[model samples]
Structures are given as C-alpha cells and as structure tokens.
Target: MRADRLVSLVLLLRRHGRLTAPALARELEVSTRTVLRDIEALSAAGVPVYAERGRHGGFALLPGFRTELTGLNHDEALALLVAGSRRGAQAFGLGSALASAMLKVVDALPESHRDTAAGAVQRLLIDPETDLLSRRQVAEEVPDAIVAEVRRAVFAGHRLRIRYAAVGQSPKWRTVDPVGLVTVRDQGYLLAMRSGADRTYRLSRILAAEELSEPAQRPERVDLDRAWQERSTRFRTGGDQVTVLVRLDPARREELVGTALAVRAEETDADGRLRLEADFQDSRHAVWALWQLATSAEALAPQWLRTALRDRAAAIAASYTSQPES
Candidate 1:
C-alpha cells in the first residue's frame, strides 16, 4: 500500500505541477507529515523534487522530469483522458483518482500522441453542465464521504448500511449486500441485494452510508452488465407505463421522442404533420413531455391526457387573461 501511495504521490504532484503539503495529504488521504516524509524519500531517490517558500508555496518537480509510461497506445490513452474529463468519476467520488491517472496517461504518452490527443480532447466536449440554450442539467450531489464509503463497501464486497430517501417516501435505514455500482448520464446507482432480492439505490438519495465487516451476500462471480440489464428491464416493465398517440410538427418529432421510452409507430398526418405512438414511464411523464411542445404537438389518443393538457392550458390562459400592459 505504501508503494502504491508513493507512486500516487508522484503522479499527483506531476499532475498539479505544484501542491501544498496539506493539499497533497488531502488528495492522498494521508497526513501532512507523511507527505513531507514522502517528498524527502522521493528527493533522496534523486527525483528532482523541490520546495518553494512563503505564501502560496508548495512542493514541485524540476521542469521536464517525467516518469516513463508503458503499454498504452494512443487511442487507449485518449480514451482514458476523455473518460476522466467527464463527470462520471465525479459521481462516484473518484475524481481525484481519475485526475491522477489522467496526468500519468498524458505525461507517459509518446511525444507525437501526447500533443495531438491533448488537442483533440480539448476540442471535444462531453456532458457539459448546461446546453446551448443555457438550460442547466440537474446533477445529483452526493457527499464525498458518503460516496467513498459506499464505493469502499461495493469494492470490498461488504454489507452496507444506508439511510435512504426513496421518492415520495420517508427516509429509512437498511442494510444491503452490494453487488456492483453503475453510473449512467451522471447519475449513480448502487446495485445490491436485500433479503436475496435485487435492489438498486440511487447514490444521491443515500443520506448516509456505513460499511459493515460482514461479507456481502452476493454471487461468487457477478456479471455486472447482465445484472444491471435484467434489473433495468424489470423496472421499465413493472412501472405504470403509459403509451400516448400524438400529432406533432415533423420538426418537433425528436423533441417528443427524446423523452419517451419507445416509439411504437410513426406516420405522416393529412395536414403534413407527424403522428407518433410513444411510450412514457407514466401518464404524468406523458403529459409533461408533450406539453413542452406546446401548440406544435397534440395528444390524439387517451382522452384523459388531452383533457389534462386542455385544463393546464386553460388555467394558464385564465391566469394571463386581461392582464394590464406594463
């Protein structure tokens, strides 16, 4: 473990260019004294590490000192960098580790690949916090300590205790045997089992987490991909899924399809509009999604949905009716 820490320490400093003892200790999850000791050891081993004095001072390597990298082709290194650049690692509280690994990859790449890949990554953006219209995408914030504890339990195959807040329900404490973790579109889920039944808990909803010493009651070998897929299938099928038929301007077809689970059928209307049968998670979802398209879309089937939309539109119209011009 110390050996790994030593290498990680080097990688962190190399990545950040300079870091204070306290900063290094925090990233390495050690003490400032340990960081000092490590720096001394690295220096004694002729690692060209030096310190600056006064405010804003920290330890740094002499310019151009790079440890050799091995076995990584250009594409592999680029893949790691691109993944690290995204919010996926942040969701799992692995941001620091990812940063260190990214630095190693960037520093170790061949001179030709390093510059080119770095440029490519800089130009390619993935999953920005907001899109072109400046509408922010909501990202669930899980406390670093809680995420780390949950991650430790998942990796060690230990039982986990969590205070969870399920949607539309009160918070409750429960113990689960962690099977694996999955992150999709910046959301994190803990795949686990409770009483031999599969359960998935959103990491953000976990008010707290405790890793227990007891072994997790999980399969000896878990095919995480298959497990997640099976669980997802069950969830999508078991819900109050609502299918809606809608007539929408062809220009906004994607707008409706984007929020739907599936597009069962599609055709052109006599008036040159697009008609689609789309499936949504629930009636509430169906109403909300189609409502966004406003006058451009209409719910053709499900009289209740049309009524709901009519009522909503009527309410809005009533609220603004006869308003004084400012």
Candidate 2:
C-alpha cells in the first residue's frame, strides 16, 4: 500500500506540476503529516522532488522528469482502449481526459506489443452511434460547464445549487446534496437529496449549476451501488405502480419482463404461453410497453387496459378500413 501511495504521489505531481501539502493530503485521503513523510521518502529515494518555502510554495518534481511505470500488458492496454471508446464519459465531461489517458497508455506499451494491440482494437467497435437496424442512439446533451460543476460537487462533497427544468414544469433553482452521478443508457443523472429526500435529476435537465462554498451533508463514505439499489427499490415501489397480468408468447417472455419495472409473478400456461404479473409505473406506461410487443403479448387482466387496447386497435383498423371518396 505504501509503495502504491508513493507511485500515486509521483504521478499526481507529474500530472499537476505542483501541489501544496494540504491539497496532496486531500487528494490522497491522508493527513498532512503523512504527505510530508511521503515527500521525505520520495526525496530519500533520489526522486528529484523539491519543495518551495513560504506562501505560494509546494512540492514539485524536476522538470522533464517522468517515471516510465506503465507496466500494462497487451490485453490490459486493449481493455483500456475499449473502455475509452464508451460515450458515457462524455456525459461527465471527461471525454478529453479519457482520450489523453488512452493515448498515454498506447504510447507506454512495448514496441513489440504496440502494433498488435492497436491492430486488435481496430477490429472491435463499442457504443456505436447506430446499430445494424440503422436506429441511432442519441446521447443526451449536457452543457460542459454544468457537468463540470456537478462533478466537482459530487467528488468534493460540496453542496450544489442547480437550475433544473423538470418535465412539463418551469425551470427553478434548488440546492441539493449530491450523493453521486450515474449514467444509464447514455443519459446522465445526478442522484442527490434535498432536505433528506431523494431527488434524482437528469443532467440534461440541469440548465445551470454552481458548487457551493458550504460542505455537503452526506456520508463520508458512500457505497454507490448499494445506494443506487435502495433508491431504485423505493422508486419502483413508491410510485403509482400498476400490476398488469399479461399472456405472451413463450419466446417473447423476456422482452416483456425486461421492459417492466418488476415481475410480481410468472408462470407458464399448459398450452405453452407465458403468464406474467408485472408492475408498471402507471396506466400509460403499461399501455406503451405492451404496445411494443404488438400481437405477441396480450393484457389479460385490468378490464380498462383491455378496453383501451381494444379501442386503440379498432381506431387503427378504422383508419385502414375507411372508404376513400374520389
């Protein structure tokens, strides 16, 4: 662990040029004393590290000094290249940083492995703009400045004031305690809280943002995965959840389940059709999701849904069957 810290300290200086002891301590999640000790160790190891005295002074490395510590194998290098291909990083305003890091990784590879790894990465495509069906995956637009401020607030545990435009509502300003930022299906969301109540805001919906001087009121250490799960559970259960019983083709069972919020019960009919009880956000959500399956799925219960589907089908049939007067 100490060795890793030493290497990290060197890389931090190499990347940022110079940093004060307090800043280094904050970045390394250690105390100023530990940072000073690490500086002494690095100097003792002939790392050419020097410190400036008085205000406006900090530790810095000798100019043009860089450690060639890139020990990535061919596969590791290719893995990083693949990860860098994702568009999700752009939502968080790290696109250029990711690109630069990938370039550095490629340059640091051994001469013999470089060409092979580069050639292999060329054959693999990730997060393509369009799939074989010619359907485009449009990424949500997030202002670079807004994303940067939100990101800083989340990472630095600072309160954030945002001008948010909720769906069908006028934009308004609100201050939130940022828990974390998440990207799902190319859309970014800031999972935060206002007055201890969960407030999940989409990055695209943020018109503006400012990182506040006051510290955020949140846990020092957050388990993002677990927190996301808990929030997901609350969202799925607390909304106007409607249960839909559906009879679907056995083959399309997964398609129906995947689009639903949750499956309450599932069973197979004797004739081989799949019967599922699924929870949806609301009536409209249920109708829209079921419509995608077309004739492959049927809404079994909730007579109103059946009527709505019947009426919709009748309207469609009427449109096609209408007589044309010439």
Per-candidate TM vs. native? Answer: 0.70, 0.74
Question: For each candidate, how many residue pairs have backbone atoms clashing (under 3 Å)?
Answer: 0, 0
lDDT against the true structure, per candidate, is 0.87, 0.87
In model 2, which regions exceed 4 Å deviation? Answer: 1-85, 323-326
Task: Tell me the tens digit of each residue's lDDT in model 2 across 1-326.
Answer: 88889999999999999999999999999999999999999999999999988898899999999986366544343335446446767777766656666777778777988999999999988778998899999999887889989988997899999999998999999999999987778889999989988888999999999999899988778887888888889889986789999999988878788889999898899999889999998999999888889999899889988988889999999988868777
Regions of candidate 1 where Cα sits further than 4 Å from its true position: 1-85, 109-121
| Weakest 10 consecutive residues of candidate 2 by summed lDDT | 73-82
Listing every candidate in turn, what is its Cα RMSD in Å to the true structure after a full C-alpha superposition? 14.8, 10.6
Local accuracy of candidate 1 as per-residue lDDT tens digits, 120-205 = 98898777889999999887899989998998898788999999999999999999999887888789999999999999999999
The TM-score, computed over Cα atoms with residue i paired to residue i, of candidate 1 is 0.70
Cα error, residue 257 of model 1, in Å, equals 1.6
Q: Model 1 — which ten-residue stretch has the worst lDDT?
A: 73-82
